[model samples]
Target: MLSAAATPAQLSAQAASGEAGLERSERAAEEQQADNIIVTGRAQKLYRVETTASTKLPTEPLLSSQNVSVITSELIQDQGARDAQDIYRNISGVSFFSYAGVTARGFRQEEIFFDGLRGDPYAGFSVPQLFNLDRVEFLKGPSGMLYGPGAPGGLFNYVTKKPQDKPFSADVRGIVGNADRIGGSAEVNSSLGGGFAARGGLFYEDRGLFRFNAASRTLIADGGVSWSPGPVTVILQATRYDQELDASRLRGVPTDDDGNFLADRRWNHNEPGDFLNLRSDVLQARIEAEPLPGLTLDATMRYNDATEVQNYHEPRGLFDSDGDGIRDATIREFRDQRRDEESWSFGGNAVYAFDLGGDVGNRVLAGFDHFNGEEIFAGRSLRGRNRVVAGLPSPLSLLDPVYGQSDPATYNQGPFSIFNTDSRRTGFYLLNELTVGPVIITGGIRQDNFHDDSDGIVFEDEATTYRGGIVYRVTDEISLFGHYATSFEPQDPSVQNPLAGGPFAPTAGDIFEGGIKTALMGGRIQSSLSAYQIRRRNILQVDPRGDVGNDGVDDFVAFGEVTSKGIEFDLAADITPDWVLTVAYAHNDTKITGDNGGGGILNRVGDRFANAPKHQLGIWTRYQIPDIGIAAAFGGDYVSEQVSLSGQPVRPFMIFDTSLIYEVGPIRAMLRVDNLFDKTYAVSGFIDRTGHFPGEPRSIFLEVGYAF
Candidate 1:
């Protein structure tokens, strides 16, 4: 949903998000300094993004020597994408891992930031809906140099929609779809005079699920105010999110290594009275100042309060008590949980631009950030034994399950854990970029000190990470780049297992990447091809030496390593003024290079990471008919076969999606069909004992909206 041109209001929004930079030329930079809003009225790719805020450097993505992808609000609305899961198919080398978790570049990635700053959007399980969002930016590979400790694969940053100077505008929409789906949303934006603007949006949905007695409901509301009274700008915003899932989280359906389910596709053991619910409230503020030409400063602060309550029934395992070689029932356990958390963070940065004589230009940036969070949890201590209710249907039947059975034993729980956790981190970072002739050099370093306390047990560590990259423009339309980066994450300290050894060491990651980027067809086409190798060390692995701890449990050791290398290609093209196309493909080969007792004959070494597909492709195109206000879009996503954690083969899948749209001055309607062919495939493989996750079936949705 990118655009070729925008008004000055849009320019201000970009600067507030830290995405405004020297994209085209020196003149653009001068104009931006003079008015703090650059004019890019010239022709540009409609679906291509030139810059991102993830790097924290005033450089464009084409010259940054890194891989970053942008999903704009336009694209999201046109494709009828509701959440991050629906949009994952459009990104390269990204796949679903678990609840709100993704497999990125051969590793599990769940880290999310808001407006380029590390903060939780909606904590635990539920993913945030794409309402009141300007865009979603993804940075591939380790970002420890700027963001701090994280998984090596990559991270996601969601940019919030900001108030803009524009005529009064309002929109309202209603949605209807299969599976008893119904929803509605409304948004309003206007200039309130006195150098002030305000925007607000609200969304609500209630949808039915395939699982019996399982349904979902979500509500989100956000409002923000922006003021630009002279050389400084300030923004304040607040958001509230509430969601509830009718049952405990599903693990997967019971299946074999070949992904053939043994039970009904909708098989579930959750009781009718079980539930999982979450509530979160956030307050955010940002300020930007341009006290002098060529020098800019910005600061951000956020405070969050959240709570979660869950009470559900869990399936222990299939029980074949009849000894007839058939697992007809499951042992059940009742669990109750309550969690309350509060978090706050502050970040500020200063950027200075100056000339080093000649045609050389340089920009130096310095930043400091701090974060603190605390959580208190009280949950059932035991999982299966003491928590297991003894009564009719407590050990639910898998074949002919009966519900509405009451178990008095579960009315009162036995043992419980009242755990309190506190975590704090502070970081200082510096970045310098130099542009000379057709060559650009970028380097950054960050030092972070983190402390964590869990029920009186404390762990503290400090780490310094580095990043360096270079981009050489071969011509005005082609460029070559190379990058190197490192990452670090401290392992939460734990008591030495009697047999698994002492507290584990921190995990480390590094990557080497090179690529070529091209913009052709007079700015109508943009493309990039890159290859990279990433290595992760000191990962935890199940101890293969047998349970030496003698505590009746499997042990783990910090002696695992993995390597991921891949090639990625992405392109966005505007064939004509009315037609647009986008394609992304990736090939990744991930292997475990080191492990604990990895196979002597048949082991974990050389095995691909779970849920990591070797090949992935996504293509989307939209064509609008001239003067008719009609547009049609067709898209497909293909993912190669992947292995599950239980060594099961998740068959490859190709899903086609189509949408028809009709738009007039103030009214619009869209009909979208997903999984057009109704392919039955597994979304992901979860556990050894459970079944693989099932993919959604064919669905059709119709939406109507009006603009005033």
Candidate 2:
């Protein structure tokens, strides 16, 4: 049953989980600095993040009045995190919809940015390689006041590794893990002459999945050059990534009538020849100048090109046509799809600081950004060739399994039809921060114009959003803050209301949040508690009164509303010289408050949103024995039950992970095990009962690295 509030036990369970991980990381960073040991660039610290450039201006987390989580390179290496999904365990109220799509606060986050610039949609869908990244930042809540149009769930930003102006240094790492995982990466950083420096990295991996006939091979190369001439500095960065997957993990396993998963945990239903390939290229240039004292100007431009090709035989689930107790046959569907996207963006910002006499200061920031994107998609569904592998009286028998019998080439027939789309957006914003004694006030406003054209239909929309916040320092160690923000997201041009004969209007969202942040024990411990409520209007819903066209197009109306409210608690502490702990918990309750006479987009009013768990908890603790050069870490994650869009209940699950680390001189070794208990669960799923995504089984990975 759905509830409006979380139970005391649910809240406490999540709170305990969140604090352990936060404290461990904070303590580790402090100890490393105290011992004068440099690790991964510049000693990744979690107790205090003093500045974040992603928020349009460098701002401290405590003063910003928004919840932000920073996953540093040190943490990534410690946990052996390879992708975005792997890092989400340390953040609260965040989960994966699939390998690509992420959901926060009950809404899907479709927009992603790289180094403060808009990212290509297609490229964002692929699994990102973290070898060349310095850090990953998550800004929770609506962010349209700073960025452009986006989902209200917030966004993710990937910060690239920058060139170093220091002595030449290099690192090489090799990885071997279960499921046939083998990979290696190399990075080099050096300083040229005349204040110039360069950094380059190469990464390659070939891995097999727990399921049969599913594997991936990937290669990535990244390089960047930075030069500082007098007061002006310039940086140029580029990256190329290519990947091939034997089959997509999107096609999940089937479930029986009683919502029980039918296939084995390691079962894969795709044909042997099914595969997906992706190629992406990105180039970015940034320039920063201080033309006058107390003033700074910066400009950035980025270009991205990506293509994806996929051909797969997807499983459709089992059917008992004759109403017998056992399954009759297995249904399968085939698809041949290709997508290409090219995008470019240009943005600039100027900031000036001045004193307001008598211990007061002010800073003003102004920025403008413009982006253009074009995409082409071609897909063909082999419906006429749908196959039902009959004669297998009971395919669910555990004794023996049959697979790879169907020839996918017979269903590969396709006469591809191309669909083209173009999108353009331009936005400008102004922000100001005023500090007086122990109080800081911040405000910002933005205006955006968005245009989209798809299949010869054009839609243009404009939005104006604003945000305001206040941060008051109650003491040197504690700060209290409150914020309000508004956002708007335009609808896709292809999504139309048959009754209105046009695209629906953009959705609008508003949020109010308040929080308290504290740093204790001489900055060895940091903790925060925040509560927020968000309301989104103009959501689309099916119209029951409207007639359905012969083409199977159903009418829709923009008269639905959704509400998401939650409280999050996070703590990080260095309990002692050798012990560190971190923990985080989030309790989110999301439901559709209003809908048309018919149900909402995927459910009826008052129904909890799909894939949005009410309780989420994580804890990670690490201990080091300096004399013996050994370190160990243990972590666990918990997720409450979630409801599917179709109102099916997904069970709650908890999993544990551990790592052992050993280091001597320039050599380091780590052994990590994920899912130590080998619990079988589903992380996500589709609306229908046909598919359920199963969690990965227990796996072990060992990594070795040498730094010089």
Candidate 3:
């Protein structure tokens, strides 16, 4: 939560103290170049202005009264981030909860944006490469004002690296690592014919896990062109990604009740038959014009299409206990699912700066914006394989007959039962900012209209969101700020179709937040603290007694409330002339403020939310030596224990990472190590289950590149 300071004057004094220490550290780092400089291929700085969350006024996007984190291209390269998931790991207050491609923040969803365009984290479609990215910005808090409909946790904006004014530039890089993993990227940026510029890039990577024959491959392509004439500029871009996985199964080890089990060695029981495939395409167009002095207008249009397919199988005999001390039962089950989706969004915004008459002070930034988007998702699953047959009984009763295969026809596990679902939304917003002397105040409002149509089923609704904030410059290096904002999202429908029997409905939320930010040491150091409380309504859950194979009961439909109260702290500083450090912390209490479980186990656990970690901490530090052209970085993240559906606490785990880089003229070489300590832990998985799968183990990589 945001801490209360003594006074504005006192805050400034504290900032000064912090700044002095940082400058000294930098100087010391420069002197100890040999020890400080480790070549790591990560970005060191970022563009702070354009990456914020405010969509109404471009002027206030930099200081939008919301917590913002910027990850520059320099940091991406330095950290050797491979895909979108890697970026999420580097950022604080974010965590991937399950292999379902879902990320969580204070037990809520995490929103995603690409080049300021909407993207879905739950689609489970694509993992974009960082090769063509310029930087990534994390906007903390509900963003219903800027986005049509969104989550209350926060949003991530991935800014693409556009073509520069330079005539021509090209780069080719490659990385070689364990598990026969070799990958490379090619990027080119150039000035085309008269009044035009273009950029294009391609990337391909493959890697393996410690598990037998488990490997994955990813391919990405992105290209863009811009045409400029007079005060107008038009740009068009396209991006495509395809990721393929051979096979991966949930990890498990031998255990004897009481949760005691073995280590890295897997029990020779479960079958190795699971795989996933994903493909996505994105196309966008942008137009910008300087219609008048101190004013600029921008309009953007984008289209996205994605497809995902997965074949999941869990051996029914995974719990085998043979009289000969061997895994005998060979039962098998598989689920195949496919989802195709298409969506497009169009939006425009205008930024105007004006001055009030006389000594009343000058007011800058009057703006308005509008956006609309639509998406469709459809999928199905098949279950029921192993038949129960009475047999001998041991400490663990053995009655069910288990085999390696099941009848696909009997289980209804053939092609699929098609059920199309769609979510569409539109929004209009207006904002104004007034700056007088050392104080700046901003106010804005957004009207949102959302419609969901699933298989011709329609649900329409609308809401108006509002926000207001003020910032007082206590000193040149410190600022005091507070903000209040409201946001919402259309809840997922749970009512199954009368004929098809699939779920449909909408859930919404209300969020309130306040925070403070400070910049010191000639803008080399930045820090912020924020506190927030989010309340949600109409939370959806599955019925305990309802037919798992059919939608029969209405117990799945219920009304409930969840509240997430949390404090976040972030800091970035140039500790020494050659050293930089970034740190972040989050403490959250997310729970069901009002209970209505609809007969689910969740309600029996005192209304506690699942998969919500109470505490998270992270630190990253890098040292660069211009004299010797070397850089190095080290960091790790820690998450507190989380509770399961049975009210059992899952053990916590920590992951550490480090990298080094060396630069000689235009040529650079780097090495990186993830999970350096070979810490056995579970990054993400299901709850209420004992044997949590082990995450990626110690991995090493080497890379070489040249730039023009």
Write down the lDDT of every candidate, Cα atoms only: 0.76, 0.74, 0.61
The reply for model 1, stretches above 4 Å from the true place, is 1-46, 321-324, 381-393, 397-401, 406-410, 495-501, 541-557, 598-606
Candidate 2: where are CA atoms >4 Å away? 1-48, 121-125, 257-259, 321-323, 384-401, 497-503, 548-554, 602-606
lDDT of 1 by residue, 1-708 (tens): 111111111111121112223443443434322321112222143244556777777556667687777777766877888887887776787888877788999888887888867668577677778997888877889989888888888888888988887889999999999889999999999999998999999999888877777788989999999999988999999999898888656657767657776666666767777788989998999999999998999999989898888877766677675789877666666678888989998999999999998989999999988989898988982334322344423666656767756453446566678999898989999989898988998999999999888787777778899999998987666778999999987775443333455456678899999988776644456777889999988876667775767777667677777889999887776676667777788899988777676442112313666899999888887787635677888888888998787678888988888999887667789998888888877888876556678777788889999989
Candidate 3's residue-wise lDDT over 284-303, tens digit each?
Answer: 89898997887788888878
TM-score of each: 0.89, 0.91, 0.82
Query: Of the candidates shown, which would achieve the greatest TM-score relative to the real structure?
Result: 2
lDDT ranking, high to low: 1, 2, 3
Q: After superposition, how far is residue 708 of candidate 3 from its true place, in Å?
A: 1.3
State the lDDT of candidate 2 residue by residue for 1-708, as single tens digits. Answer: 000011111111111114664774565565553332333211124323456666777766656676677776766777788876787666677876766677788887756788888865346547776788888777788888888788887778888898988889999999999888999999999999898999999999989987667898989899999999999989999999898888663555665534466777666656567788899999999999999988999999999999999877655545554567655445556678888999999999999999999979999999999999988999887532223443211122222345555555555455888999999999999999999988999999999999998987888879999999998877666788899998988876877533354577789988999988766554556777889999888977666766455445667677878899999888776676667777888899888877776775543324777778889888877777766668888888888887655556666888888889887677789998899989898876655524567888898989999999
Model 2 C-alpha lDDT versus the unseen true structure: 0.74
- Candidate 3 local accuracy as lDDT? 0.61
Candidate 3 lowest-lDDT run of ten: 1-10
Indicate whether candidate 1 or candidate 2 has the larger lDDT.
1
